[model samples]
Target: MFKMADNYSSSKENKEEIDKNLKGNEKKKFEINKYLPYILIILVLVVVIVLFANLSSELNGISNKLNSLSSAKPTTSVTPNSTTENSTILSDPSYNITGSLIVPPKSLPNDPVITANASFGSRLTNINQPLNKSELALFNNANDSYFEEAGQMILNGTFGGYVFGSTVGSNAEVKILDNPFVVNGKPSVIYFGSTTCIFCGENRWAMALALGKFGNFSELYKGYSSFGDHDIPTIYWAPAHYNQSAEDLGNFYSSKYINFISIEDDLPITGGFQLNPMSTIGARINATNNSVYINAFKFILQLNNFQGTPYTIWGKYNVLGADDADFGFKSEPSGNPSIEYKTHNMVFDNISHPNSEFGYLEYAGADLYIAMTCASINNTAPICSLPVIPKLESYEGYN
Candidate 1:
């Protein structure tokens, strides 16, 4: 009986120790479960940070690519959808033929009529008008894709969308004849201006940019009007030959469909108020021959009593000054002042005047109107068939 009781006491003590060890294991398991949520949260945070870092790198790469595209000059070549293959009309034509006769207005019911004057305007001053090689390179390079697109926009008369300033004198009408001036069986243009004229200097920017569309220019010299004037940079046509071929053909001869009679008459006065006389070939053309320039000037004077300088005669239409339909950043009575030229030049005071404030794109539409109006007179040139011409023709200002 004593041996049985000792065995029972040992068994009871062993069972109690076993129950205590089981409770300690349960407490340890509960503590581990309490810390598990924190560990899981930290792991999720690390994964999100890694993903954001990858996305940020991709975005930085995309931003760099965009910046390069915006700053670099465009190198893509553009070709018109139209073709010149097997064309009856040559892409390049020599506009050399018999000159038109300019007749003086009849006085007192048909007085003795004079055909032409032989006196040429005298060159006012001996100002050097040559542009350096570096300057020319800068100008050519600047005429990149954006400049070309501006030209195209003007031709299409779609520049109104980009208008910026007051739209005054966009295209003021004087008078147009059903039959305009013709040369070599094509329409012609006559521009009479003076180098000393401030308005002419400002007008030349848009005029040069507009004319560049129809043909190329060669030996174009750069100069400013009289320093007393606004002193803006102008493409002095005294030496420029427009509508010429890229191969540097002879001056005063156009390879395009139309002809230009550009006359620059007077130079800025050096120390005096009186402008010096500048000799011009156009004056010679007017003196001894039947010239449209002489007739146009005389007719304009008769119509408006010496309206102003920088007069343009496109066929029968008489455009007195620079015209822009669109508004600019600054409103101008004559033109939109926000438009600028691509070519750069320096003023007399050593200040660099690179761009024009006039609306070039808007003025380009005016020039296109002149070209298309002339085309309507003699629709022989292939350029007349361009789709943009019709859209420009529909505008009200052209009539």
Candidate 2:
């Protein structure tokens, strides 16, 4: 009986201990459930804060990039085989000359208008005159060094700070055509400009430099743009009488590889604009007239792209306007030829060195023309093999 009571007491004690442990576990689980919503809420708030911070940082980074691009200068660099969007409109009124006589014809005339005088009545006062011998000597002697440096720059793919194929503000770039304008089984480079045009005055420097690479200028004459048109000092490829006559249709460039034909107006700016004369070659292009190099004039007039003075056709490529703007010397006071005269002399003196301001800018502009010429001629020139020439050609959409 004693043994049976002892066993009962022990069993009763074990059951009480088991019940206490179960109640403790139930109370702990209830406490955890009560705090579970608060824990989830805290975790969601933390995740939201982290996501907002990351989004804010990304937005700030994007904003900074936008600001940087908006404040940057106009770029004069281009990668090869890339097409840049041109923001400028071709028909912008700012590009139009107020009284330009070189207008697009309704139809190309079969023959040139034959005038008895060819001097455009009494408007033409002076005729072709040679430049001073002393002045000509300076340019002739400096040709060798200038050519060497210009070629070097083109080969290097950069001139001054500008890339070989890039263009500056509002300046027209070279456009490729389907066929080249050829003369006597040779490619022809034609230029039509006026002595009174300020852009023409500035562009001649670069044109002369680029042409020098392909040919030789046996004779160049001293000329001034016009008194009303800033009277910029310029060089004429042919003997020309400034502000006087346009009857002299002679050129001095001799190139066996390519023919250079220049048709320029001798008349300068009168009454703040050039005089209107229908008889001069600048005023009208006669298609069938072989005497005045009418083929080039007719080609330009037929194209809807022809705008104004300083027009050039480089092989199959056409540059409708000045390749570049004024090279810092164009700001001289009107009627003051001496300032521009000195500036031209300085450029001539430093033509061989790219360190000078005028020299660098002129050479950069020349490289652009040179690249266009190379593209048109199928890279026949020795300098065309340079890396920059191909890059420039590719950039301008050449084959």
Candidate 3:
């Protein structure tokens, strides 16, 4: 009886142990199965989120670019404040030039009219007709301050037009077009010059006088240079000396020299090129080498970009180097302190400027790495003015 009881107990114990082992294995299997679905779902969601994020970022980038391109202006010659907006009147696709149709000054007085007698006249030959009498009178005679403000604005950008002429020369060869006085209608132009350049700055009136014997004349006058290395307090290149800023170069230039025309802005410039060439004026107007100046802004566009008041671009030809007595300089110093520095060269003589280089070359090829829009140099108001350039029939030049 005892042995049978013991066997029964042992059998019961074995059965309980087996049951526990089976239970533990079943629990582990259940845990793995439960986690499988969640793991897979989470991986898929992460992939989807990454892809969506990339797509959304790309779309936003494209949208921003589209917005920027939509609004911008170019530098072109548009009719200043003309009602071209209200009316669908495009500019004269075809044009002609009469006494009134004449464009603003482009030539030195002697070579004023781009006629057969002038060297640059051929450039105009391609034009079908003479300039249209698109004359617009400027404001009442303004003051020196007003002219400075206005002229600076012009140098920075464009203003209105003038009934004048200018020489057609490559600014790349020389900085200035020519001493308007040097070849005034190819006349007595004994000498002419300016102060800063020791070459051309103060000679405008003198050259005009020499050429005045012929029909030569000039809208030219002296104020200062457009650029410099440093701005001493009383120096022309310094802001303290002249009220010039990046936004007023063009206005300042026009106020002092060109016909006192006010440049207009605040109009829609749709389809205007960001940096087109037409917007750049010619040698006589200043927009000529602007593109190049724009290009050279990195180096020469500093204080030296344009010289201003009392400081002008001078000219002298009878002698060279005001300090040298022989060529016109001094014995102790480089030259005597006189108005005879660098000799002026004629327009035709420019080809071989190996010895004497002009300011125009640097002006033309300078760096103007400005971005597309809002790239204007002058855009100020309450503009200043100077004496109206004594607009004669044309700019002084040699025949």
The TM-score values for the models, in the order shown, are 0.46, 0.56, 0.19
Q: Per-residue lDDT for 303-375 in model 1, tens only? A: 3323456666665555655444322334544532322221223221111222332344434534454444434
Candidate 1 Cα outliers beyond 4 Å, as residue runs:
1-97, 100-128, 131-171, 239-253, 269-306, 325-343, 346-388, 397-399
**Positional deviation of residue 245's Cα in model 3 after best superposition, in angstroms:** 15
1-399 per-residue lDDT for model 3 (tens digits): 889889999888988988988998899989989999998999899989988988766764565344323322221222222445233332111111111111233322222222232122012111111112110001121123322332233233332221012222321111221121111111111111112232232222222221221121222221221123110000011011112111112111222112111111111111111111223312222443332222212111111212212111112111111101111123325433222222222311221221222221211111010000001111111221112122110121211
lDDT winner between 1 and 2, please give it. Answer: 2
For candidate 2, what is the lDDT? Answer: 0.57
Alpha carbon lDDT of residue 169, candidate 2? 23
Whole-model lDDT per candidate: 0.44, 0.57, 0.23
Candidate 2 structure, TM-score to reference: 0.56
Ranking by lDDT: 2, 1, 3
- 2 against 3, candidate with superior lDDT: 2
Checking candidate 2 for backbone clashes, the offending pairs are: none
True-structure RMSD, every candidate = 23.7, 19.0, 24.1
lDDT of 1: 0.44
- Residue 175 of model 1 has an lDDT of 36
Better of 2 and 3 by TM-score: 2
- How well does model 3 score by local distance difference test? 0.23
